[model samples]
Target: MIVFFHHLTLATTTTNPSYLTPSTARCNSTAVTSCTTTTSIIARCQSYEVSWNNHCYYLDGLGGNCTTGYSLATNAVLGCIATQFASKTYRSTISNNCCVWTADTYECYGFNNNCNTAGPFSAGPVWSGAGCLSVQQRYSAQLTFCGSN
Candidate 1:
């Protein structure tokens, strides 16, 4: 399952009328189709939105960004993401998608077991742009972890 808090603007280059509407958008982590089609999610609002048992947290809204350090093929926390969230109120410890331990995102990852596990572990690096795709692409780190230490 995919869960995100920040609002997003879909496709920005299209002249189609649907682009003008506000809703959940779909963009290429690279191609970026249109911003008009882009919907809204979040802006300055940051919080730990937990799903399932508590694994899925919407890592957006924070002043900073997030990313996974571990890999699915092998467990390793080598990457870096924004630990500073706009909220920075909680200490979140992020794990990779595989459930391996990862660096701290200033908050804890309260995820449930499989089946109920929050999916699409986004290793945020949420960027500054006109829209979601305009910024960075949040891919599943295949990493997973609990909240902070």
Candidate 2:
């Protein structure tokens, strides 16, 4: 099997930007990199104890389907837009306080096999590019409300 890999970085452009996860977040004592501009309409994320007093608003989604686990994830969803994570993932876990609306179903940024930089995505939700093409791909908040489509 040919395994594809891509790296992602998120940033906020909204005036009232809220983080689904903190920029200096860490999991199992490992620092988690948070990106901005990621949001969703599924549920309003606020604050919570991710694991036994560990407070956070960390980004939760498929690292290997749209749900996270304790490690790098396995059989994860591919090409789906999300915060921080940009590769196929599943069952990965993060412990932290997330942003205002951290919906898993919503689009953020992920990798498409042979992923390359698509041009600037439109002004609205979030999208990703590998950095040198045109056209933006979009996902639905419906996904967040429900699950990966």
Candidate 3:
């Protein structure tokens, strides 16, 4: 039987990035490498996790979707913009932290401390990239809230 493989990396502009999954079936403890199947990759991602840029990310704050995670989430200090993560859910286990944007990188950076605001929603998992980063590194790289649909 010929088994077709699904490539997880979807072609997307930074302005509208799509959720990615493991491209390979067998992945090392570090990166996804050559493999002959795809089931392993799919299993790698958790229920609350989504794959992107060849790695697993937790579902955090979301942009666009015509809805906000919390009341003050739209504040300028949060740097919530209708950019890459717009219309899509941002992955993180942290709180009202900003998704720091650099020249070529945009990772959710903050702590587990919730913002001084209140709403029907709550912060998502306090993840550190689901094995993507060390626990100690989580201090600089935090997660986002899991907003409602």
Give the number of the best model, judged by lDDT: 3
Name the lDDT of candidate 2: 0.25
Top TM-score hit: 3
Q: Least lDDT summed over 10 consecutive residues: which range in candidate 1?
A: 70-79
Across 1-149, the per-residue lDDT of candidate 1 in tens digits comes to 99989988887675623312222323323423232313343333225432221122333211233334311110011111223322322224333332222232221122232211233333322322112221222234422322221
Which runs in model 2 stand beyond 4 Å of their true positions? 1-17, 21-89, 92-106, 114-149
Q: Where in model 3 is the C-alpha error above 4 Å?
A: 1-41, 52-55, 59-94, 100-149
Better of 1 and 2 by lDDT: 1
Sort the candidates on TM-score, descending order. Answer: 3, 2, 1
Q: List the residue pairs that clash in candidate 3.
A: 20-51, 60-145, 63-87, 92-143, 92-144, 93-125, 93-126, 93-127, 93-143, 94-143
User: Over 4 Å off in model 1, which ranges?
Assistant: 1-30, 37-46, 49-93, 97-123, 126-149
- lDDT accuracy of residue 17 in candidate 1: 34
Per-residue lDDT of model 3, residues 1-149, tens digit only: 99999879878765422122112222123432232222344325444443332333333432211123221121111222212232233443323333322111233223233322233123422223233222222233233322222
lDDT at residue 145 of model 2 (Cα atoms):
11
Error of 1 at 46 (Å): 7.4
